[model samples]
Target: MERGDFTDLPGLGKPLEDLGPAEQGHDPDWWLKRLVEREKITVLPPALQLRRDDAALDDHLDRLGGEAEVRRELTEFNDRVRRVLYSTHGGPPVTTPPRDVEEEVRRWRARREERRARRTAALAAREPEAPPPSRRGRWWPFGRTGAAGPSDG
Candidate 1:
């Protein structure tokens, strides 16, 4: 009943690699959870997803280029949270509160200023560049007049 269809497959004869001691007793879906995490899959329900996003919101805001972009991101996050809260579709309860736009903007500004200060301090710590040489008093290898060649009188 068999052809060479599976002969060329990778890890064909090698034993499976163990992740670690399995927590199968404590959690029946431990393998599934590990697979999800290993694959970097995002399959959380809306409420839980919002909570995760809320946790990393500051980091998200830091990457934005401008205050308007930050405001837009905050507004979008809040809208998603509010939508999850109002929906009857069940998952974990939505406990993540909507962020205040003005307060976040203030915090974002403060963080930007702190980063700028740190960068300025780092630059100041480096040695200053040397000034360019002057043109009027140019140096010559032989003499100011000309090269000491045999043709000179």
Candidate 2:
């Protein structure tokens, strides 16, 4: 206790930060609920999940490789959206329409090209690599091609 090992810890003496629900009055499990929300734990229905995925689909598509892969992902996403749309055992209605595979693929291609162009331009803007130092002058220090210096001449 005398060693002060616990000193300088973050928020050592400060009151705990109040999570939002405390103002609304106490639920015994508020901490648990807050934990779940903070962790982004989703128990959302298929329709809602699909909506979230729809909004971030382009970001997801950019991570995938090749047109075929992008097409496949878009098709799978569309299939899920359609399924939720048609299903009767629903929660919220599926508002996210199926993405157009061709259109998404076109966009993915354009993004890829733009990234490539940026990389190429960045490389072009950098200083040209200096030529490798010549080895010919090293071993033959007397002169290049063993030519005599003025002192020797």
Candidate 3:
């Protein structure tokens, strides 16, 4: 779907669609870092002053645990901010509708249950008891012979 379509969604609002081409090349990781930094600047509290100092921000973004931690923090902050904005603006939550797709799911579940019940009932009805073997005739591995013993021609 187009960026506008995603933005028009009830709760999605306006998510960043483009992070711009990297200076060197179209590096996804570089774009991700830029996006994360931008999101942090926009969503996080200025009063907290987490990245206020340029040196501190660079150090924090470059430490051993920096990339993963920064990405995670940015993601969480963005989600919370989005949720608050959507709720304030009367946008729907991200949850799926119970009636929309659920009706078909419920119908499928019911049909599956009914089929299982029918199969169980059919199996019970068709169950056969073991019977004793009869010794009326000599049963040979090949076709039956006219006489019980081997032919004495």
Candidate 4:
């Protein structure tokens, strides 16, 4: 049929060839999935301290060791973490602990560093002795040793 010959058709005016790429290419499911995904966008992750506080609070509660108030504190702490996670940026900080939270964070960081150092030291101590540069293994022929060979002696 001609481009404008919709008079011959009964209901629809447009011809099959006149449809756009989007209308022609994708099925209804594909369009629906795209719409659904756009509707259900994932929220951004929380700040580092926010996530860290979650774990730190967990540790503190663990150290409290099933105290009567631990459950309450855990619930409250989790709520705070969620707030920090979903809260908008450029606003005021999330927490206002009565105790020195920064001091506690420093202590946590120091403990982590010390643990890391001890682990590095242990790994170093346990490291296998590499063969001397003069010796060549099947995998590695080049070494820091001099290029001179036994024939040069």
Error of 4 at 12 (Å): 14
lDDT of 4 by residue, 1-153 (tens): 568776666657545432346546645476566666779954433555565565567367445533345655655665666666567776446553333444544555566567679999999899698877773443435543655554322
lDDT values for all models: 0.86, 0.83, 0.48, 0.57
Tens-digit per-residue lDDT, 1-153, candidate 1: 198788789998775554444453355576898888799987889988998899999998999999999999999999999999999998889999999999999999999999999999999998999999775533554645755655423
Candidate 4 TM-score to native: 0.28
Candidate 3: misplaced stretches above 4 Å? 1-99, 129-153
What is candidate 3's lDDT per residue for 31-137, written digit by digit as tens?
Answer: 66777787884543432232243224324333424334655544454454444545544333333211222343344456556767999999899958788877554
Alpha-carbon runs more than 4 Å astray in model 2: 1-40, 136-153
Give the lowest summed-lDDT range of ten residues in model 2: 144-153
Per-residue C-alpha lDDT of model 2 across residues 20-116, encoded as one tens digit per residue: 4446765678788888979998688888899889999999899987888898899999889888888888488778999888888888999999999
Candidate 3 backbone overlaps, count:
0
Q: CA RMSD for every model?
A: 8.6, 7.9, 22.9, 13.5
- How accurate locally is residue 18 in candidate 4, as Cα lDDT from 0 to 100? 25
Q: Rank the candidates by lDDT, best first.
A: 1, 2, 4, 3
Higher-ranked by lDDT: 1 or 2: 1
RMSD of 3: 22.9
